[model samples]
Target: MRFGILVNEGPFNHQASDSAYKFTEAVLRKGHEVYRVFFYYDGVNNANKLSEPPSDDRHIVKRWSELAKAHNLDLVVCVAAALRRGMKDELLAEGFRISGLGQLIEAGIQSDRLVMFGD
Candidate 1:
């Protein structure tokens, strides 16, 4: 199956981001394709390159980047949401790109399932 993932929460502020990541990992491991992972609202924070959690905490942003690299996944941050949070192209982590909501729409149209995490 092909999936599109939408995340609407921040990495540390809620469990939504973590859940989305795990779900994506599991789906890929099951031989499914992820069309795209769209980060909207506070979820755009997942693309922030400057985020630094405590050493003991899992680095969610880095994990996303690594996952994208490993799978050649498209990790997209909503341009409007990112701009509202002061996230620019230079501030984005590896494997993440800033794009408009059209990408999300495209994902929904192309993927067999559109899985959303968070409100």
Candidate 2:
């Protein structure tokens, strides 16, 4: 099955992101495919590659990046959320390109299920 995972919480001050990551990992291990991981609201922090976690805490940013790289997953971040949180991907910050709900819509239809990890 194809899955679309939507995360809506920041990596810190909440367990939503970690839960999302675990859910994604489980989906992949079950022989399912992830259409995309959509980051909305504070979830956009997952896309900010500059995140630096405390030495004792887990490095969630790098873990998310690895998930995308290892599985060739589409990690989609909501442009509005990203900008509001000061997260930029060079292209967006430079040319002011922005992602929209369309990305979420497309992934939803293409995938068999939409899983939301909320706090």
Candidate 1 to truth, TM = 0.98
Instruction: Write down the TM-score of every candidate.
Output: 0.98, 0.88
Against the true structure, whose lDDT is highest? 1
Q: What is the alpha-carbon lDDT of model 1 when measured against the actual structure?
A: 0.97
Consecutive 10-residue window with the lowest summed lDDT within model 1: 44-53
Residue 113 in candidate 2, Cα distance off native in Å: 1.0
- TM-score (C-alpha) between model 2 and the true structure: 0.88
Candidates' lDDT values, in order?
0.97, 0.80
Question: Candidate 2, 56: how far from true, in Å?
Answer: 2.7
> Which residue runs of candidate 2 sit more than 4 Å off their true CA positions?
91-98
Give me the runs in candidate 1 sitting further than 4 Å from their true place: none
